[model samples]
Each structure stands twice: as C-alpha cells, then as structure tokens.
Target: MKICVLNGSPKGNESVTMQYVRFLERANPGHTFTTENIGQRIAAIEAKEEEFKKVIAAIESADAILFATPVYFLLVPAQFKRFIELLFSHNAGSAFFGKYAASITTSIHFFDHTANEYLHAVAEDLGMRWTGSFMAKMDDLLIEMHQEELVRFGQDFLTTAQQHPAIRRTYLPITSTRPDYKSAGIPMPLDCGDKQVLILTDAAPGSNLEKMTMRLASSFGKAASLVPIDDAKMNGGCLGCCRCAFDNTCVYTDGFSEFWKETVLPADIIIFAGTVKDRYLSAEFKQVFDRSFFMGHIPAFAGKQVGFLIEGPVAQCATLQEILRAYPSLQGANLAGVVSDEDGIAMAVDELIDSLAARCLRLSKSGYVAPGGFPAVAGHKIFRDDIWAEMRAFFRADHAYYTKHGLYDFPQSDLRQRLSTTFLSLLLSIPSVRESAQKEMKKHMIEPFEKVFSESPVLKRQKKEG
Candidate 1:
C-alpha cells in the first residue's frame, strides 16, 4: 500500500521525528512510503498553487496518511498548522476524505498527548478514518525495548489501515452559534488599580473575534491597552534551528522581540482574544506561539493573570480547552477565565465577559497566581531536567536563566536530607526496625505536615480566612 507521510518538522527529512518514521518504513518493507516536507516547504506550499496541488495529489493517491511531527507549543509547528489552514482555505479537504490516518510525534513528552489528540481530531474533521497514534519521548527510539514496541505499533496501524475498521470520532464537529458576538453596550468598568492590563489579539477586522476583543477591551475601561498583534506576519515560521539557543536571539529580525518587550513584559494582566479556527485558534495566532520559541524554555508570562475571550465554540472543544488552560499554567501565570461565544444569546455572553473582567480584576488586586495544574507541574520538571543535563550545551541562555532564578533545584542538592535518607536506609536494614518502619510509614508521612498545619497560616486557616 502507498502511504503519504506528511512530515511536519521544520528540519524536513532530517527531523528526529522522521528518523522514527524511517524505522517504521525499513521494518515494513512490504509497503511503500513517500514523504512530503510540508513543514519545511510551507512557504512554497502557500505561495505556489502547483506545489500544493502536488501534495493533494499525493494524498489522493495514498491508501494511508502518516502525520509525523514534533510537538511545538502543545500542538504541531506553526508551519504545519498553516499548511492545514491552507488545505482548508484552498478547498482540498476532499483529498483526505475516507483516507486511513494515524499520527506519530516525538517530544520531551511535554503535552505530547495534546499534539496526538489534535492530529486525530483534525484527521476526523477532514473525513479520514483516524485509527490510532503512537507517541514517543524524544529519546525513546534509542532504547531497544521501545524500538520493539514501536515495531508492534507500526504493524498494528498498518493492519488497521488495510482492514479500514470503523472508529468512533474523538471530537464532534464544531458548529458556531452566535459567533458574530455583539457587546451589550458598555459593561461596568473593572477597577484595575495599578495593575497593567494588556489585551492581545489576532482578531481580523470586522470579524466576530474583533468584536469580542473590543468588548473585552471596553470592559477594562482605561486600564486596558488592547493591541491587535500581527502574528501572521511573523513567518517563515520557526525553522527548529538552535541558533537562538545560545543568546535567546531569534534569527528572524522581526518586530516580535520588540512586541514581546513592550507589550508582554509590563503587563500584570493579559487577556488573549481570538476566534476558534478549525480545532484550535487561527494559524496566525499559532505563529505567535511558534515564534516565541526564541525565548527557549522560559516562562515569559510568569506571575501574571491571564484570561481568554474566544469568539467560537471553544467551551465545547475539550482538547482545545486543555491546551488553553495549560498555556497560562505551564507558563507560571494564573488563569482568570476563558469566556467563549458559545451561547446563542448575546446578553448571556456579554454577562459572562463582564464576569470575566470582574474575575481578572479581583485576581490582579489580590496578586494571586493560582498554582500550576497537571501540565504545569509535569512540564516544568521535564524542561528543568533536560535543561540542566543534556540540553545545557545548546541552551546557554536557558542555563543562565535557570541558575539565576534558582530553577536548578534538584532534590539531590540537599545534603542533610541525603544524610537522613542514608541513615534511615541503614536503620531499616535491621529486621525489627524494618518491620516497625513499615508499620509506622503512614503515620510518619502525616507527622511532618502536622507542624505545617499547627504553625503556618496556610491551608489550615484557608477555610476561615478565605
């Protein structure tokens, strides 16, 4: 069977993700695999109609489609995303209809599931029979055990493709309700005080997103500075080139750096406004995320209050919601709230927007950035470990930042704790002590936190104080 591999890496065939795809090809010599570097050649694909036709022709002829890419900003690269946007804008969805599809991604395992789920949903939206996906940690392919598992995964995908088994859709189609959102006049202004409120948006002029952003800006009154970011003008997308790693300097001499410095840095509260395009935000909006890779693994929005004003059915897209929530959490920012125009009633959405404004003000005034959730905690560790170890040589800027900010906080740094652990281990070696330790394990765990409750004005007093 002929399979078209949609290579979503900016490195084209040289990508680490493609290495795994090549392994699958070598293992399964019976099937033919052809690769298209859509990520690398997105400029050509978007500019030249003939180049795009060639890609569609490949998809039309293929029995199966393989989406191979590395996860960037919890999704596909901005270039690959733009290619998908082009496919929709150019009316090329028919090429993928009824095609067997599956995705494979390589990442630090930071939000890898979000990327895989995103592709699966996109495939389903394109009328493809998305069978399954294989996710791998960046170094998983180096292990023989993982290699064997990958082989089995490839075989299972091929067998499923040949059989063309019916699969339930993971995401239902998005239907816009009252997308052309109208603000119910001016809302009661939020008292932002000394907090710097910046509303960044990529809303197209006269679009529903534009209206939503306007409403949100007005809700903040004079305290908010709304700037419609031209994130679309940024690419030539991120090329995955590590040039910026050394100094946090982007290769592209764009106005993005200035925008980051001027708009992003001073803001205490940031509200992102955009419409849902396809399964996520617009590719233009994604360009902002992809281009921001220049900052490496740094949290640019740390200690800020973030919110969203979406002009589509964002509330319904769980995967999108998770990604959205993860952005603020993983970046060390607090989520004020995400309000979408899913409600058919304009007044209801307006009320929600007003409530969102109130929420942002309250959070800002209190200077409370809520603790990071699942994505934030796990993602921090992944980046922290990688930056401290193997990735250190390449990411000098990250290393410097991490060291200065005390981010290299490996638990092994505590010599006293290590000594205590060693003593405990030796004590537990004796049979009687071991049995006693096992019996008292749960009690010992609770013992340390007892002081925290009695002394600190923390969780213990939250019920009464809060």
Candidate 2:
C-alpha cells in the first residue's frame, strides 16, 4: 500500500516521532511510505500563492494519511491547525472521503488521547475511515523503548490499513462532490477568481504545533497561507469570573479583544491554536477565547465558522467541548471542525461539525424553515421504528416477556426503571439535565423487571433490542 506519512513536527526528521516512523518503515518494507514536512514551509508558501497548487496536487495522490505529531496541550501543533484552515480554503474537505487515516502522537507526560480524538474527528468529518490512534508518551516509552513495542505499533498500523479498503482506490478526481464550489470560491463581498486561500495561524513558525497544522493543510487543501502568531505582547490569561453578563464585554479588558478584531474577524474562518493545561484550555488561548465573548447577544457569530487546533493529552477535548458549549459568543456560530489527538475528540467534533455544516449549508441554499410549534421525536421513524421498538420491550409489564428476553433478574418497579433509562441516555447526550432532577429520578428507578415488562407491550420489544 502507498501511505503518506505527514510528519507534524517542526524539528522535521530530527523529531523523536521519526523513530517510530522509521520503525514502521522497517517493519513493513513491503509497504511504501512518503513523508513531508509542513512546518514553517507552509507559512512561507502562504506568502507565495502560486506554490500551493503543487502542494495540493501531491496530497490528492496519497492513498492513506498518517498524522504524526508531538502532543502540545493535548492537541495538534498550531501550524497543523493552520494547514487545516488552508485546506478548507482550497475546498479539500471533500478530498478526505474514504481514505484511511491514523494519528500517532508523542508527548512527555500527557495521555495523547485528545490529539487523537481531534484528528480522527477531522478524518470522519471528511468521510474518511479512521482506523485508530497510536499514542506513545515519551516519558512512558523511555522505560520500554525496546524493539518489541515499536514493532508492535508499526504492525498494528499495517494490519489495520489492510482491513478497510479505500473508496478511491487510486487517483482522486480533480473535482469534489460540489464541483462548482472551489476552495478559492468561498462566498465573499467581492469576486476573487481562483484566489488561493490565505490563512494566518496562531502558531510559532518552528514549533511542532505549527508543523502539524501545515502538514494537515497540505494534505487536505489546495494552497495554504500560514502566518504565525508570535507576539509576546498578546499573551494573557482568563479570569475565571463571568463578568461579561452585564456589559457583554470582559471586565479585565486586556489585549485579547484586539487580537480577535485585528486578526480573526477579517478571515473567512478563525482557527484557534493552543495546548491544554490541567485538563483545560491554555491560559493564553482561553484568555483570548473569553475576550472574544464581547460580541455577545449581537449575533457576532451568526454566520461564522470557528475551528480549533489544540495539543494536549487525554482530557483536552472534553475541556474544549465544555468551553465551546458554554461560550456565549459562539451561540449562533458554526463549529467547522476540531482536530485533536484521540478517537473520542474526533467522534464528538465530527458530530458537532457535521450537524453545524449541514444546517449552515441548508440555510445558505434555502431560507430558514422552522416548525410553527415545538417538534417532538415521538413520530420520527428513526427514533420510533428503530429506537423506541427496543425501548418499549424493557418497560413492558409482563414478567414472561422479561424472562424470555433474559431480563428476568431485573429488580422490582422495572417499568419506571425502563422509562428512566431513556431519559438518562438523553440527558447524557443532551446537556440539559439538572443534577437535582437526575438524583431524584435515580431514586425512583428501582423496580422488578417482570412487572414492568407486563405493563407495556411497547417496552417488551424495547427490552429485546437492549
């Protein structure tokens, strides 16, 4: 198989992650692997628009992609994030479909899960088949830098790559699903014919974060413009207090708002790049993120798309989700996509971006359509015929039904328990459940399974599916 190994370390071939790449190459001599360094080079090309054409061509030829980086704050390096933004500019988002992808990260003490999740999400969003993650903590690997573990990681990648088949077996078509739409053709006030995408990243030119951003962008986009954000004066921190409730502006009024107004608002999309600390967004990144909230209630993000490139360990993504869900400025915005370091980040970000992109595209092509009244899931075939059929069986009041389904051991008051299960699942997915209500509901879920199964025929079927 022909594989494209996108090395996202600014250190280039000198990066420790390269050792793993070497191991993979040695273990699977039968497979072909090509490596590229995006790093500061992307930012250089951003200044020369014509060079991007060649970069995009190379990416389209690759069969599978390997996103290898060193974790920074539980996310990909900032430059790699910038590359993604540039890829969007070239409209390379569609090029990722059906391709096999894997993420390998090296971090000293972090879990590298967030980085994996974010990268996987990017792949999934592009309709790619994400195999899995290969994470190695430098500190942990120091104890087992033996040939066996390195060989195992390489073999695992090779085995997984062999399992799933590629959608475009060879040679990607020049045009995407929406051929009329070009990366350079994003909607703008003025017409810019075939104008390559120009993106500025909040990454240092020589850093690992920057390398990851450029590598991803080059792999996925037409041409990229990467400008590093290296202003020491721009560094700041978020004050935990939610003082923006009154004036809708941050009270601490540092240089953060200026960064957004000066750097972010002017672009077609804003890509925030940073690392994670203590399972949360970096102080500097969070400070800017919080300060950007000054556009509150005025619909600053009504049509904007915000993307994030974070580097950290295990919990970076959870922290990112919590921040996004609670951020006021992003209320009406579309979250384009987040590339993290683990499978979970990819899953969550994919769902969020797909939903956001679908709705935004629908609205762009057609006007908003809202039901005259509240909509319910009761009659939806996806929920009723598929989901409810299983739910109903568990809540049925017939003890015989429970026994047939192997749920006879369920406790008393099973009807209430079955009903509560649906609610709990919904609460877990939907973030609106109150702690007090959840606690009270848990107390009422203890019940006999047989009695519950007999009470509802609908629940009986649901139990079977469960």
Candidate 3:
C-alpha cells in the first residue's frame, strides 16, 4: 500500500516528527511511504501549479494519507496551514475523498490535543475515513516504551487502512451563510484615558473585516490606531531552528521584533480583526502568530486584554473558536470576548465593543488576571520542566526569566509539605489511625477556610488597613 505523508514542518526532512515516520516505515516493510515536504516548500507549491498538482496526484494515488507535523502555536505551522488553504483554493478536495487519513504530531505536550482536534476535523471535512491520531513528544522515539508504542500505532494504522473502516464525522458541515452586514453606526463613546488600544488586522481594503474593525474602534471613541498585519516586515514563518532559544533573537533581521516590542507589546487592549479563511484565520494573520515564536514559550502578552472581531461563520467552526480562546489564555491574556458578523453584524459589533470596553477598564483597574485553565497551567509546567532539565543550557533567556519570576515551583521543593506528608503517611500506616484520619479528612480540609471566617469584623478591618 502506498501512503502519502504530508510533512508539515518548516524544518522539512530535519523535523523531529519525521523520525517517527521513518521508524514506522522501517518497521513495516510491506507498506510504501512517499513524503512531501509541504511546509518547507509551500512557496514553491503555491507559485508553481505543477508543484501543487504533484501533491494532489500523490494523494489521488495513495491508499492513505498521513499528516505528519510539529505542533506550532497550538496548530500546524503557517507554512503547512498555507498548503491546506491551497487545497481549498485549487478545489482539490475530490482528490482526498475516501482516503484513509490520520494525523501525527510532535510537540512538548503543549496544547497538542487542540492540534490533533484540528487535523481530525480537517480530514473529516475532506471526506476522508479519519481513523485516529498519534501525538508524540519530541523525544518519544528515544524511549523503548514509546518506540514499541509507535510500532503498534503504525500496525494499527495499516490494519485500519487495509480494512477501510467506516468512521463517524467529528465536525458538522459549515453551512452558515455569509450575512450582508451594514454598520448601525457607532454607539456613544467611552472615555478610556491613557489606555492604548490597537486594532490589528490582515483585512484587505474595503473588506467587511475592515468595516467591523472600524466600527469596533469607533465604539471605543479613543481613535485607536489600526495596525495592518501585512505592514509588518516579516521575512517568513518560523523555521523551528531554535536559534531564538539561546539569545531570544531570530535568524531574520526583519523589523518585526521591534514592531512587536515597541508597538504590540505595549498595548493595554488588542482587538484582532480577521476573516476566517478555510478553517482558521488568514495566512497573513497566521504569519503574525507564527513569527511570534521568537519570543519562545514565555507569555509575551501577559496581563493584556484581547478580543476577536471576525467577519465569518465563526460559530460553525468550533476548532477555530477553541484556538481563539486558547491563544489568549495560553499567553496569560484575558479573552475579552469573540464577536462575529454571523451574530447579526451590527448587534454583535455593538455588544462586543461594549463588552471589550467594560472588561478592559475593569481588568486594567483591578490588575486582576484570571488564572489560566488546563491549557496554560499544563503548558507552563511542561515548559518549566523542559527548561529546568534539558533545555536550560540552550534556553538561557528562558532560564533567567523563569528564575526571576519564580516559575520553578517544583512540588518537591516544599520542605514543610513534604515533611507533613511523611508524618501523615507514617501515622496512617496503622489501620486504626488511617480509619480515624479518613473520617476527619473532610472536616480537616474545611478548618483553614473556617478560620478565615471566624475572625471578627474589627480584626478583618484592621488587617485590611494594614
């Protein structure tokens, strides 16, 4: 059986994810694997019609399609994303219909689920028999256990492909019609004194996206500046070179670093405006995100408020919505809200503007940041552990930042907690003591909170004053 491998890594053959593919090929001599470096040669593929047709031809001939990529910014790299866009633009979906499909990605276990979810949805949308996904850690091939797992995964994939098993659709077809939106005029202005608000977009001139962004800014009444993503002097998408990991400097001398630091980073509230292209934002919008990889895994927009102004059927695209929500949360920014033209453009714009203004003001005043949920919490821990263990020597800047911010909150470092656990364990070794402790565990947990409420109003007031 011939399998088409869409390698979605800017590093091409050098990608760590491809090593797993090679292992699978060697382990299964019966199957033939043909690899296309789609992400690395996206520009050539887009520019040359023949090059693009070669990819479609490969898919048409293959018995199965394996999407192998490294998770970048919670999804595939911008280069790979562009290739996906080309499939839609070129009307080549028919080539992939009925093919057995699955995705494989390598990441630091940072939002890998979201990336896999995206690929699964994409395959289903293309009318493929979506089997499943194999998400590997970057170094999974090095471990004996993981090696066995990879072999099993490959065998399972081959079996599923040969049998041609029917699979349920994971995503509903997007049938939402594009609404004709006309601005109902901006509402009364709010006085956001000394607050820097930016409307960043990749919308073309005279596009509905531009109108939505303008209306949102008008609602703010502060004459916020619009920063077109195309105006940024970005050279290309991240190469996964890890050069920035050492000194926090990218290989390219593009002025994007200065623009990000001097303009984007300083904004108190940022409104991202874009039209949903294919299943995600535009390639230009993706470039803005992909280029930000120079900042490494740190939260570059911490404490900032962000809102989305989308001119598309966003409600129908659950994966894109998840990406939107997860992006801000992972960066330690509050997701003010996502407003879409599908919700009756005028009404949605007005409500979104009002919500953005209110949330920004409240957050700015209180300086309160909601704790990150599972994605950010887990992502931070993964990066923290990776940096402290293997990456410390290369990622010196991350090490310094982590040390300064006390991000190395290793659980074993708490001597009091460790000692208390040891004492409790020793006591609980006896059946009688264990029974007594189990009975009182609930009450013991409530004791700390009870003490807080037990304080007198006078004492509480004095503590507040102090």
Top-scoring candidate (TM-score)? 3
lDDT of 1 by residue, 74-122 (tens): 9999889989888878878899999889999998888889889989988
Per-prediction CA RMSD (Å)? 2.6, 19.6, 2.3
Per-model CA lDDT versus the true structure: 0.86, 0.52, 0.86
Per-candidate clashes, comma-separated:
0, 66, 0
* TM-score, every prediction: 0.92, 0.40, 0.95
Please identify model 3 stretches exceeding 4 Å from their true place. Answer: 454-466
Pairs with backbone N, CA or C atoms under 3 Å apart (clashes), candidate 1: none
* Candidate that beats the other on lDDT, 1 or 2, i.e. the better one: 1
Of candidates 3 and 2, the better by lDDT: 3
Predicted candidate 2: what Cα RMSD to the true structure? 19.6
Question: What's the distance in Å from true for residue 359, model 1?
Answer: 1.7
Which tens-of-lDDT digit does each residue in 287-373 have in candidate 3? Answer: 888888888878888998888888888888888998898888888898888888777656665676577667776676567667898
The sequence of per-residue lDDT tens digits that candidate 2 reaches over residues 274-336 is 544433444345334434545432325444545566554424235357444333122334455
lDDT of 2: 0.52
Best by the lDDT measure: 1
